[model samples]
Target chain A: MIVKSDEKYSTLGSLESELAISGLKSGSNLEKLLKAGYFVVTAELGPPRGADRTVIEKKATLLKGYADAFNITDCQTAVVRLSSITGGAILVGLGLEPIIQMTCRDRNRIAIQSDLLGAAALGIKNLLCLTGDHQKFGDHPGAKGVFDIDSLQLLQIVKGMRDEKKFQSGEEIEVEPRFFIGAAENPFADPFTYRAFRLAKKIRAGADFIQTQIIFNVDKFSAWMERVRALGLHKKVFILAGVAPIKSLLMAKYMKTHVPGMDIPDEIIKRMEKAKKGSAKTEGLNICLDVIEKVRKIEGVSGVHIMAIEWEEAIPEIAKRAGLLPRPSP
Target chain B: MIVADIKPFKEIMRLVKNYRKICVIGCGTCVTVCHAGGQKQVSEVAAQLRLAAKLEKKHLEVGEETILRQCEHEFIDSLEGLVQKYDAIVSLGCGIGVQMLAERFPHTRILPGLNTKFMGAPTEPGIFWERCVGCGNCILAETGGFCPVTRCAKGLLNGPCGGSQNGLCEVSPDTPCVWQLIYEQLEAQGMLDTMEAITPPKDWSVGQGGCGPRRLVLEHLVEEEKDKHKIAEKVLTRNDCKK
Candidate 1:
């Protein structure tokens, strides 16, 4: 196959043919890290709302080598964005591993299965199954939501495709997708007592790694981890503590007041507001480092997932400060 | 029960503007009980149409009628004689009632005066909550009798989607998360073990998924009528043979 000088494959057909010969193994590097007993680090990469390739390419350049893998978000917050498959393909072309996030909000089973096959064909190894944010919170509120299968069902379907070499309908696949499946859990959400049980349910649904919602309340997260340990679930899957840096006082207040499933403590808000005039960003970074340090010491925590949102530049410093630098090669 | 809300008066007036004579028909069952479209509402709509037409100096004829049940043929048969008296009909019944009126009086125009909301029941004096989606397959046995198919915004069957906070849905503070409710109910009953099992993907074909309209026929009733027809045919054949 003759490759382009620019390395930008225009069509998926060509990409598929090229990947077949590239000898890129169909498994996640993050999985390898977890198995090797390395404290892994991952971060989120939100796709642009429009067809702009440079937006992700630029962020990928900054995020490369700072984390084991990047989670390419699929229409995060229910707003329309570049498809996760396309974004993951772009990251793959740039030689970065992407854990493509699949949501149950916009596609039915048929579409979901087709996209899974495509993601596999594009050399995506990691898959995160999310029920996604409700469409009411996003730009298109009038759109019809297609939650044909929730996240648990999605995990089962992916697991069936991978392990059984069969589709959701029990039909055989010519070549099954090999994905290190992941699922999200929230410990701060209401009915907190049931949170660990839900995590156990995700593990049963074939979640290889568990990424939790961003944590600001360390005491609550520690308690949740305690429940997880009580159930003996830590042995089953890798648990990554999700943490995000608050860039400003406004973002902190908004996340506390507006965002659902987030627990922002009053002290964190007070700390953010009291940051020295020109050094709030540094304070936010410090707060994030503190969280990583705290969660890293927790018994069951296997890694930390830093979601810097639009502040990708802060990841390298955060990772270095937290002693997670020199990302290991799998 | 089916819940419906009347369309705005301006929209109703616009729909009936071209017709010189119109009749406002209301349902006496579901819509009546819901206070959306009943005898009282029909009279009020008719009077409002008259007053608006008079103010506009437009000559118009308006009539009012309330049927016991617009969905049933027997209840709406009383309007047979009055069907030709009006140019158009504005039905204040649920979607099924409007369709029934349209199906019965094929030649006349049947316009809906209310927007059919959902299959629900009154939660309070003025609030109604959707309870069932008629998904054909019921998993309430496993879910502690709470219908997540209808009450949940995403219709998630496995568990709450990590968005429930303080027992309320993430979509709205006023909307209680059905999964949280289910969890609490099951926990109280000491049945939390039931929720641990993963619910498989729903069989959507049982509902009106890819299939068209659904129909239920009582096979025994149909067989009884067929038996009578067979007897009549046998007697006719004997008479023909004798001739």
Candidate 2:
């Protein structure tokens, strides 16, 4: 995603913004998932930049068991896909709840709004909003960008359709889609005091839950989340810390250099680098598991999104080792 | 640079009313750059028209395609294969580009999806401003770079419109009087005398007059067509068939 304009740090306010979250206040999918006491692991499967589906299928199968819902990303990183709609349908047929991640980058308000209805007709329940990366960073550098609406606006869009029964067109929406709207957060990337406040804005904008960017430092996330509670965010929102296992030294370096607002501590980098040959990647993976184990204990965090990338098979092993088996139902 | 803006789907559906086979034509030029009339817009328009047709319980065949620049002859030639295949073509380009398509597809009806707004320039990233009017004359050397004809509400040349009050257009407080803007610029450049130098009356015959206007700046190209309507569209469908 385009490195967003510098985030304005503020306190997560009282739930005074009338975001109309009644559809999800009780019997929503997120409500059900949380009440079910499953650890509620969701993973993002960004379609490869090329036309190849072979790698995607391999990754999809590998991540199947570890996640309660497997997300098929729509043009993630501003790169085009083999149609996330079709990919989501494929995942649905494969016997999984497909969380379709949509962005405001490629479609206008109508297209995005209509696509949600399309997804609903096909039975996708989990929806994630993103103000995707600009087109320049993707494979198709020349494609025109369409930021018709941003992520917070998209959340409000869904909230309006489902709760308010209205479309962007102002006509009464005939076929409103039911969705568990999830927004994104970056605690480590944001300063400690400002993180919760930004998250509160998303919550007030109608996000049912938030899936944060990967967490490398649990202490930093927990401290940031303590402010999340002090600001009273614990009562209104569900926050999920993002967890992506570092597979190699190169991946860690890439997160540091290429990924904006992401900080991979030198200690973690050194820990990954110092491991003996075959064990380094596994050691890095263990750090993610440990981070999740501790973050799970953090009072405000609602869940975790384990994005294992190509090494999806190790997710189950990692979760099992962290004692997150059968995902925390409730 | 493609210039584009979104429009309601129902309005577009009404424009292509009686056509059985509708082809959505996208401009890869300014419309694409504006994120409006490109492959994505074409696809969405095609999809919406299909959805509308399906809702009406009519299986109308709708096709989608785009060309490099609908305003140019070379670009129009690229659509020969797809053009003849549809009963009507809905163009998603500015007024100039749409008329060009109607001229190129002489035997087919050309419909317009977007209502061309103004001769504007990208004011900010993803924003455009109505800056020029192609008024068949330029006084950029004397008035600095601002064109008084387009920016002024009254198109007054010599000085600010009497209706201006406190640097704002009386018609709309939000709009700044162009002459006032020009005055500030000239004063900044020590060229404020340009406003007092009484210019001769404008020659109406020099510009395109009624609807469209075209003019050339000193550094740009211009085309003065004596019979601009020579490529006027003829109705391919008889009145009895479609009311």
Candidate 3:
């Protein structure tokens, strides 16, 4: 195909087509690290609920060299916040690679495709597909959920757009949105035995990477990983186990009791409660470090995705204490 | 079967406040099985309305009648004479029956005394649960005879969503997650491979969202009627020749 740089539309189309065919060479640093067989470390930045660019920038700066790439959550828990794309763009400007999380709860197929194109156009490389928390849990319970497609379908759609160079309708795209596809796994959720099988299904659907829900019960997670290993899914996709540092005893108790799908053992909660007032955060970090060390040793486990949540400042220290820092240079 | 529940007595009373004479109609089919709008329930509602009106010092005449099926025109036609005598008709049948009565007795004001829940069978003697939304296109064959559209809280085609825990739905710990049941059933049938296939988005046009007041016409039946007309004409011609 003859490409022209001066033609307004053709230039953009050819540029994207070049990137798409080259296996998305300009992909995120996480993709590079995973490809290079580096023990990767990722973190998350929950974009502020309001229009605060500095919040995202500060978090990005804090996590700059501590982690490979951090994810910008798409309205986590269905509570509306800064758009992941915008937050991701800001992180890119701040020299931090971002994995833009996209949820199926708020957008239909058209919006999802449009946002993918827009995100790719703005230099966003990583995409994490999720079936977001139900709207009933969010501030807008009255809002209609447009799960036009679920996470599995979302993964398939992104894969098609990137690999097949076509839309979900099978129409050819001049410029495909090449992304490093990722999907979420909840091992602690339900029918615990089926969780690994479900992860296999996600991988089959074209998820290049997997990030799980926060792990407080490592034994159960290991059982799930065993199933994943039995299927040899670890060889097909990178599995990043999720860990979140509990800031206080109250937070641990809340996650254990209030959060659905979260299985925090009573022993961990008791340990948190026993900690002295000033040392609770330290105890939480220690527990997180322990989980990280243990998870790193598990076969088929690639890395850890530390979700510091609102406590972004603790991520650097956590990564340092956990011996994950001095991130590998590309 | 369409399961229903009786509307609050106060609501029914308020609906028929202006009418002095009311005819309460019931269906003997699905509603009867559900104990909602059966012959027995019709009498119960009539008695309640009568007592309630008497207590309020209002003269009210509540007549009770039960039909074999309110959905069929023949059974509903039986109430032609009795229906006109009443100022209003209180239908203890499902929503379909209430609408059928309204179409049959255009002059009588029809009020629904029961809330039509869903097309479902009773799990036990008294407790009822929804099993179908009548989306028109059924995929029970693929889902191990379990209807994810009706059972899953999100109506997910490829489920169970993350909310499923210990085979129970996150919406309610009491409610068993239908997808989990489907997975187990499919596994038991040695059909776990079926769950691996991603179900495409449903064709809503064939479902409730497509259009309004859907009807099915049998073309062969119409063709048969035409054939009967031709046969009748030939018989008449032969009879004329004899004459």
**Highest-DockQ candidate:** 1
- Model 3 chain A scores worst on lDDT over the 10 consecutive residues at A2-11
**TM-score of each predicted structure versus truth:** 0.94, 0.54, 0.86
Task: Name the weakest run of 10 consecutive residues (lDDT summed) in model 1 chain A.
Answer: A3-12
Each prediction's whole-model lDDT (CA): 0.88, 0.70, 0.85
Least well predicted 10-residue stretch by lDDT in candidate 2 chain A = A1-10
Leading candidate by lDDT: 1
Question: Model 2 chain B, poorest ten-residue lDDT window?
Answer: B226-235
List ranges where model 1 is wrong by over 4 Å.
A1-26, B230-243
Candidate 1 lDDT tens digits, A1-330: 111112231111222332223333345788766665667889999899899999999998988998999999999999999999999999999999999999999999899999999999999999999988889999999999998999999999999998899898999999999999999999998788888999999989989888999999999999998999898787677789999998999899999999989999999999999998988898999999999878877876778898989788888999888878788888
Runs in model 3 deviating more than 4 A are: A1-22, A48-65, A89-95, A142-144, A326-330, B211-213, B225-243
State which candidate, 1 or 2, has the greater DockQ: 1
For model 1 the interface RMSD, in Å, equals 0.8
> Which fraction of the native contacts appears in each prediction?
0.79, 0.00, 0.41
The candidate maximizing TM-score is: 1
Order the candidate numbers by TM-score, best to worst.
1, 3, 2
Residue by residue across B1-243, what tens digits does model 1's lDDT show?
Answer: 999999999999999999999999999998887888999999999999999999999998999999999999999899998978999999999999999999999999999999998888998898888898888888889999999988899999988877899889999889999999999999999999988999999988877554767678999999999999999999999999999
Q: Write the per-residue lDDT of candidate 2 for residues A1-330, one digit (tens) a residue.
A: 111101121111222422223334424444566433333567777666677767667766766656667778787766677767767767776766677888766887779888889987887778888766656667787786665456666777787887888885567987688788877776764233335655766677778777887889777777888888887775566677788889888889888766655667888888888988988778888889878877777765656788776676777787677655654323
